[model samples]
Target: MNRYQVATAELASSQKSGAGVPAYLRWVNRGLGRRAAAVAYVAGLSPNAVTLISGMLSVGGMVVLVFLPMSALSAVAAMVLFLAGYALDSADGQLARLTNRGSIAGEWLDHVVDSLRLPLVHLAIALCLWRAGLPDWSVVVALLFLVLSSSWFFAQTLAGKLSAKAADDGSAAEGTPDWVSFAKIPYDVGTLYVVVAALAYPPLFLVLYTGLFVVTAAVAAASLRRKYRALLAEQRDYAPEN
Candidate 1:
């Protein structure tokens, strides 16, 4: 087999469980990431390098959104950059696993970038809306989105770590229905980027963005409660007997 083919095979074998992953991530972003990771592998690039590249691309998209005039072309450009960065975001971890160079530091860097970028994207949207002379409530919606998105990210990450620590098998309960992934489309970053691409049309963007925020907030509320309760149960189960 050719080197690229060999790299692809290796990455395919090392993929993490897809349970509960959104369809955009499972079906779209990860597929693009696998291709990018294979290319990175062939070029002998490190995972950290790939991660930095992803960050740069995302930042570039935000810059375009905040600085460039709102236009269909500009929206498309920013959307493309954001989507590419997200795909690369997935690529870095796959590359790390493929190269066996995964480290705590690398994972920390990835999460840090993600945590910052998620909020910043919404902030950029708010700025763009303010510049466009949209109503104050639209700007308010954007800021609220920033808050909700970051909070969800923090809670989800914390719950995963806590769950792993509390469980003996290092596994959360299984039997997540396959349809849950489809239901999570509204929560996907890819979906957000697609909504952000509607920036050219203020009315459309506001309607869609607000709708996404509502759906996300509802999902986050229910999911957070479930996670908190699950963690509490796990903690009680593992407590030392008197």
Candidate 2:
């Protein structure tokens, strides 16, 4: 097999479970990322280098969103940049796994970039909405979205780490429904970036953004509670008898 084909096979073998993954990431982003990862492998780029490139692309998109005057062209530019960056974000991990070069530091850097970028992206959207002379309520929605997205990111990450530690067997649970992925479109970061393209039309953007925020907020709340309770139960199970 050619080098690219070899890299593709390696990536396919190293992939994480698709359980609970959003449809866009599982289907679109991962496919794009696999190709990108194969290219990066052939180019001899390190995983960390791919990550830094992703960060730069994401920041460029945010800069355009916040700094450029709102217009159809700028909105499309931001969306393309953000989506490309997001695809590369997936590629970094795949590249790491393919090369067996995944490190604690690499994972930490990836999460740090994601944690910071998510909130800042929402903030940039808020700034744009305020500058665009949209209703005050619309700006408030953006700010609230920033808060919710950050909280959800933290909670979800912590819960995953804790649950893995608490599990008696390291193996992951199975049987996730296929529809769950589609149902999580509102919670997908890629979906959020796709929505950014609508920013050129404030009324349309507001309607879509607000709807996403509501669904994500509701889902986050329930998921947080479930995680907390599960952790508590695990703790009790592991507790020594009195």
Candidate 3:
């Protein structure tokens, strides 16, 4: 609602100091907001506004692609809209910092909106491939990417938790996120390549989608094994002596 109210709401979920939002995201947010920089000054739009609008754009883009498969031009436009949506998604934290009003609702909603984008985009891809007479395997691979990517994120989170506990017990040093918030590496690279392939040549995207899925699956599996071992180790330390 207001500045003080927003800050109070955010106190529940605010990131710890030094866990600031990543710079690449900040850079994207700043660059894209410049699209409406003068207007933001005049209208006083905040980060959540930018984020929600971008989410809408991403959804709209997928809807359009689903129905307008005949034109490569339209597909290109949809992908571009989705990209803009992601850019605005990046803008939210910076917008909060600049405005000094951040809310947990805003932070949570940013992720909720983002979570919807990938599934919808995949649906659009499945529709496109059906038209091309591709095998169902393509859709399966796409789903694998989403599922494995999610598992990888969760596995990494567990690893961090374990590391922190070990540090607390004096078994190790305080753990940091592996690298500047996981580099958004899989997402930044996967989305760009997928979008490019979708617009220029749909088959190219299918190939990239499958390739990325394979790589991500391997990474997720390895990470899961590490997390499982960590959990076992933690449990062993707590086992009672007979």
> lDDT per prediction?
0.87, 0.88, 0.59
Candidate 3 ranges with C-alpha deviation above 4 Å: 1-42, 150-190, 193-199, 227-242
lDDT of 2 by residue, 87-184 (tens): 99999999998889999999999999999888988998999989888899999999999999998888878777778542222122366777888888
Task: Return the top candidate by lDDT.
Answer: 2
- TM-scores of the candidates are 0.90, 0.90, 0.66
**Per-residue lDDT of model 1, residues 1-242, tens digit only:** 98899998988887776666788898899989999999999999999999999989999999998999999988988899999999999999999888889999999999999999889999988999998889999999999999999998898787767675422222212566668778889879999998877988879989999999999999878877777777877775665659
Rank the candidate models, highest TM-score first.
Answer: 2, 1, 3
Highest-scoring model, TM-score = 2
lDDT of 1 at 165: 43
Per-residue lDDT for 134 in model 1?
93
For candidate 3, give the lDDT of residue 11: 35
Cα lDDT over the full model 1: 0.87
